[model samples]
Target: MLLKSITPRESEKIIKIDRFVFTTFANIEALEYELSLGIKKIEAINTNYYLKIGGNEERIAFEAKIYLEYLEHFSGLVEKIKAREPLSLSTLESTKIRKILIDSFSAKTKDWLLDSSRNATYYTKEFSIGGVVL
Candidate 1:
């Protein structure tokens, strides 16, 4: 141990601590920062990525992705969901509820895709009282 190089175990532990990093944005600048950071990591280490491609679809896809990741990373989540318990505080914290509640920063690429797509807008059950689309 001449220079005391970081062990794979230590590096992995550090990565595990940041296994799920999230950044919310009030504007495009904030989103850009996260994008840059995420891009940098791809070269430094092989990593799983969850880049929300657009603002409109952010809410639509956010919860499902986070939930899937949550289920994959922690078996306790699966057990809790199976047991039919009220979501735990920690689990609630882990969910992507902000996307459902907030208007996230719009990405140009996402905006373009949504604009070009025939059915771009999210369809929330909360949006309609009846069959009428809101």
Candidate 2:
């Protein structure tokens, strides 16, 4: 996926990937310079190292199964977002929507969002004026 093109503004950092929106107060020019290079796909592998002992095999297998399930769920979610599927806010509760918003961010951006001292704020009123309420 490519980073969506946006006009750089003072004191505002907005990055869009597919349907996800990431906002923060950081160096936008630096981010834009990084994106100007190119977008590269990075492959990640999850490995589990454990001793073949009593009960360990079962535990490792259970953990592996959970990890695979999570990967599958995340992959499907990404595909849906990339496809720009229609969102029905009326059918989804607030917590579920919040989870989707949080999951949309990249790991680093998500960390920033979760940081209590970051003082992040969502512009609900602005979004509402544009026809989106969340």
* Winning model by TM-score: 2
Q: Write the per-residue lDDT of candidate 1 for residues 65-123, one digit (tens) a residue.
A: 12221222433433333443333121122432221222222212122224455756431
* Total clashes for model 1: 0
lDDT of 1: 0.23
Clashing pairs in 1: none
Model 2 accuracy (lDDT, Cα) = 0.26
Candidate 2 TM-score, true structure as reference: 0.19
Each model's TM-score? 0.18, 0.19
Question: For residues 5-101, what per-residue lDDT tens digits would candidate 2 score against the true structure?
Answer: 3422323324332233323422222221111223334455775444333221100000011111122222343454455444322111122331112
Model 2: runs farther than 4 Å from truth?
1-69, 89-104, 107-134
